[model samples]
Target: MTTIPVIDFQLHAVGKEGCVELDNLGSEMCQALEGIGFCYLKNHGISEEIINEAFRSSKDFFSQPVNEKEKFARSHNYNFGWVGLEVEKLNPERPVGDYKEAWNITLEDHSLEWPSEKVPNFKPSMQKLYEMCTDLSKRIFDVISVGLKLDVMNCEDQYVPATPIPGTIVVNIGDLMQRWTADKLKATKHRVLNPSNEQQRRQNRQSMAFFVHPDDKLMIECLDKSNKYEPISSIDYLNSRFKATY
Candidate 1:
C-alpha cells in the first residue's frame, strides 16, 4: 500500500527557472496525499525548539487534574480546548472512543477568549507555535496547489495535516477541504496511539492541532477551475464536522 510518505521542502530550494524540483516534489506530494491524505513533512520551517517546548507545555497541561482541564471542554462549535481521553470517536461510524486526546486551537480574535491562569505561560508558547505552524501549513499547501494547477495564493491561506515526527510536524487534509475539492483531495482518517510497551505507556503523549479555517461567512465550494463541489458556508462546515465527533 502507498502509506503516508515522508516529504521534504528541498524542492523549494531549487531555482524557479527550472520546474524540476517543483515538478518532482509536487508529483510525489500529490500522489501521497491522494493515496492517504497524510504525509510526514520534513524541513517544514518550524524549529525543533518550538515543537519541543510546545509539547512540554502540552504535557504539563494534560497532567493537571481532570477538573481543571474540563474547564476548557469544547463549547458551542468552538473546539478550542482540552479533550479528555475516550471523549472522542474520530470515526463515529464505529462504536469505540478514540484512545487519544487533543487540544484544538484556532485564530485569535476578540471572540477568541483566552482562559488565562489555567496553565502558566501556556498562551505565549502556544501562540508562537500556532503562528509558526500556520505559516508552514501555507507553504506546504502552496506545493499542493501548484501540483494541482490551482494558484496557491488564491487557495485557503491556512491548512491542517497531522502526525508528529520528532523534528517534523504532521499535516493532513480535512473534511471541509475535501468537500470543497469534491474529494479531489482526501481527508484521511488518522489518530495517535497510546504506547503499547509498559515503559513507553508511562510517558505521556501530548499533541496539539492548530485547526485553521477561513472566515466564517466565506462561501466554500469547488473553485471555478474545478467546479466539482457545491457551495457551503465555511463556519457551518467546521461546526458540523466537529459535531460528529465525541
Candidate 2:
C-alpha cells in the first residue's frame, strides 16, 4: 500500500530556483499527489491555536438541536450554509446518504448565514481559519508550479484513509484540478465512512474542509496541452456536481 506522503512545506525557503530543498519538496509533493491525490503537510505556517478554536466553533454549532441549526439552512441557489446529515449522497448507489453534516463557508461574509446568535465565535473563528487555509493553498500552488515547471498556473472503492499526524494538514486534489491538469494529477475518489470502533462511533468528529474553487467566471482548460476533457467554467462544473449530490 502506498501510504500518504508527509511533506515538510517550508514555504519560506521554496522560492529559490535550483535549491536542493525546493527541488526535493517539489518532487515529493507532485509525486504523492499524482500517485494518490493526497498528502499531509507539516511545518505549514498556520497556528494550532486557530485550528483548535475553529474546531470548537464547529462542534458548538453542530451540537445545537436540529431545529435550531435549521435556522441557518443552506439556500437552494447557493452552497453557503448548514447542510443537514443524509442530505448528501456522494455515492448514488449507496443505500443511505453520508452520515455527516457540513456548513459550507465562503469568502463572502454577507452571503453566508452565520449562527452568530447561538455560536458567537463561529464567524471569527472560522473566518480566521479560512483565510489561513487560503494562504496555505496559494503557497502549495507555487510549489506545484515549481514541480511541474509550468509557465502558467492552474479513490473511494478500495480507498485508504489518511493517517492523522500531529501538526500536519491533509491536502487533496479535486476534479477541477485533475481536469485542468488533464489527468496529470489524480482526482482520486474518496468518501468518509462511519468509524468501526464501537467506542469511537459514539464520539463527534469535527473537521473543517476548505473547498478551493476558481472564480466562477474563470475558465478551466487542460493546462498540460492534452485535450482529454472539454473546457468548462468553474461555476457550471460546480453546479453540475452539487446538483448531483445535494
RMSD of 2: 3.9
lDDT: worst 10-residue window of model 2: 148-157
Q: Could you estimate the TM-score for every candidate?
A: 0.77, 0.89
Q: How would you encode candidate 2's per-residue C-alpha lDDT over 122-153 as one tens digit per residue?
A: 99998988888887887788788777633322
lDDT tens per residue, model 1, 1-246: 244578887555222234444666777787766766777777766677877787777777777788888887766556666777778877666688777667777664336555467667676778888887677666667687767634232223233444446655566788787767667667766645556799999886555666667789999978644767668899788677667775
Each prediction's RMSD to truth: 6.3, 3.9
Colliding pairs, model 2 = 155-189, 156-189
Model 2 CA deviation exceeding 4 Å by range: 13-21, 149-158
Q: Return the lDDT, model 2, position 187.
A: 82
Please count the clashing residue pairs in each candidate, in the order shown. Answer: 4, 2
Q: In angstroms, how far off is 5's CA in candidate 2?
A: 0.5
